[model samples]
Target: MRGVLVFDVDGVLVDVTDSYRETIIRTIEHFTSRRVTRDDIQQIKNLGGYNDDWALCKKVIQDFGCHPKYQEIVDHFQRIFLGENSDGLILRERWVARDGLFEQLAKDWRLAIFTGRTRSETRLTLDRFGAQAVFDPLIGNDDVENLKPAPDGLLKICATFPGVEVVYVGDTVDDAKSAGRAGVGFIGVAPQQDSRRAELVELFRQEGARAVVDNINELEQVLK
Candidate 1:
């Protein structure tokens, strides 16, 4: 059987250091009315099971001794991340994969996405990168009750493409756990930035990832 490749959007494919991560820090600060540093956000991310930024923001707010309704937090987050006007959000992100990487992978393996991003957000990013047609069975947060570390998204992708070896490419410990629970191979992509890369690589290695790479472009070599 041909191999199936499942992807995590945020850290593996798109660099979220500026966009989603910034939004999480800003949202916490916005709700608490106090500054939350990127390090604070990284602390939460490092603990794993925080693929959903909305949920992460809520946790940060609650941890800071504040109580706000979930919908209110979501509204504020969407406003700031998606932006209030045509100018768009203050934060920006870029693709971690090399140009035409997905298309090239699609030629040899079935490509799919299992990400914590919402369907709309995933669509917007895919459209932006001209990758809408590359992946199949894109599983977003809305599609699964339990997210990463629960294996819900990975299992769903496996169910969709059965009788094939599935390899999940992601950047976090949760992603490795999900792939492990779902009985799929995991390739960890360490954070692109230098400061976090070594630590993240060690973390993924500790998780028993099939392989770990510093760049998404290196994924091709790992799979081979």
Candidate 2:
């Protein structure tokens, strides 16, 4: 039986928090005319949930009555969220894999990416990182109306690669829930000892995650 390992791109594989934070701040400043602090961004994001990413962002910035349409917001974020310059507005890290990753992972499973990104952006990032070779059949923002914390994308992936054991690895509670919602096993590949790490592990447990490890280094023990 073929086994499949589906992954989330942003946090799990690529550390883009800085870029994302700046993009949100810029988007808000551009449309709302109100400056947002980091705390404010977290509050809005935590409350809005995954499906509301774009819509909530627009709503927060729609105060000037000069708000652009959804596609325009999409265009704006895409243009700003990608790059490798440290002096850049956002702190987006390169999409390099964690150490000893492919050698350990690719041997046992067919890999794929399900990201909350437009196809063009996702493709570009994947291409830039040289990770496209590892992930086949990429699914992005264009593929579905709902993303993580919802299961449609992963289920779609399972359907495409029929009969494979599905293991969806990610770095957040939303990912764990999405995997569970899709009836697949979830693995949390956390990289740091953030305060939220334990909470995320517990959350995944609550959501029925098969394993929650600090990194993919623990995967072999769990998968075996």
Candidate 3:
């Protein structure tokens, strides 16, 4: 039987350093009136439990000593990310997986998505890349009661493919923990140039990750 391969959207299949991460910094500054850098965002991400970018934005805003309404922060984040008619920072996102990589992987493994993005948000990228039909049993933030580190999404995907080996490819500590909790194999993607690369690689090791690659293109070798 073909094993199931589940992937995270941001930093795994898509590079969101300038889209989602940039929105986090921009959103915090918009509310706190103070500049927030990528390093600042990295600090929070390194601490984990921040799979949901909206919640991460709220926490960072509160850390800056501003207590804005959660919904207010979310609205601003959506404005910056999704924009009025999709002309937002989200357009900056670049799919990171190598060309033809997903197609090749799908031949040997059933592909799926378990990402922190809302289902609609995930679909936008899938549709843009013309990969809307590549993944099955897509699970997004809205699909589960709890986010990463809770194993809800991974468990849901696992439930869909009974008795099959399942592996989750992701980039965050929360992702690692979620995979561990779900008793699924985990492969971490942490780019070498990232400021948090070493830290993330180490954390993935601590979580007993099956392998840690600098990018998703290298994942094929590990899967074999």
Candidate 4:
């Protein structure tokens, strides 16, 4: 059977260390007027359950004793994130995979995206990278009622391309959990940065990841 490969945008295909991660930290600081570290944001991310960064920002704001209305938080977040020109917050995404990797994969398998980003934001990034045509049935947080750790997005991909063996490639525990819930195979991509790779491998292994690769370049071999 031809395989179906579903990808998570941030941290899987695109490196978010300087983009989404920075936005999360900056958004929280803007509201609370208090500094928050990337590690702090990562802690919440590691805990899973938070599939939306806006919601995550709100939770952090509440934890810091600031209860801004949801709309207020969202507005502030978009201002910092979308910036003056509506270009982007931290436009520093680098591809995790090697060049031509996705194109090569497309030759044999159906490729799609399932991400926590809203459709507009996801489209912006994809367009920025000139990768708008790479995926089919692209799914974002807006496409479903529930996010990661819930099978809604992955289930949608499966239904769209039924009867194929679906494999999800992602970077977070939530990604693994969602794939597990959807009853699909999962491959975990740990950060390529030295010790973090080892740490994430262990984490994904604990989550029952079928295989954990330290970098996206390793995926070609693993899929073989």
Highest lDDT model number? 3
Clash total of candidate 4? 0
Which structure among the candidates has the greatest TM-score?
Answer: 3
Candidate 3: the clashing residue pairs are none
Off by over 4 Å in 1: 192-194
Off by over 4 Å in 4: 194-199
lDDT of 2 by residue, 71-139 (tens): 988666655654344334334555546666876788888888887777776776677677667788788
TM match of model 1 to true structure: 0.91
**CA shift at 37, candidate 4, in angstroms?**
1.5
lDDT to native, each model: 0.82, 0.71, 0.90, 0.83
Candidate 4 to truth, TM = 0.92
Q: Model 4 Cα RMSD, Å?
A: 1.8
RMSD in Å for all candidates: 1.9, 3.8, 1.0, 1.8
Across residues 13-32, which tens digit of lDDT does each residue of candidate 1 receive? 78877887777878888889
Deviation in Å, model 1, residue 213 alpha carbon: 1.1
Instruction: Write out the backbone clash pairs for model 4.
Output: none
TM-score-based ranking, best first? 3, 4, 1, 2
Looking at model 3, report the run of 10 residues with the lowest lDDT sum. 37-46
lDDT of 3 by residue, 1-224 (tens): 47999999998888888999999988999999988888877778879988788898888788878999999999999999988998999899998877799889988999999988889989999999788998998999899998889999999988888899999999989999999999999999888888878888899999999999999999889988
Candidate 4 structure quality by residue, lDDT tens digits, 1-224: 36888999988888888777788888888889987886677667677877578889999999999988999888877777788786665477776667798888887788889998888888888888888998888999889998778999999988987788999999888998899899999999876663445656776788788898876778778888
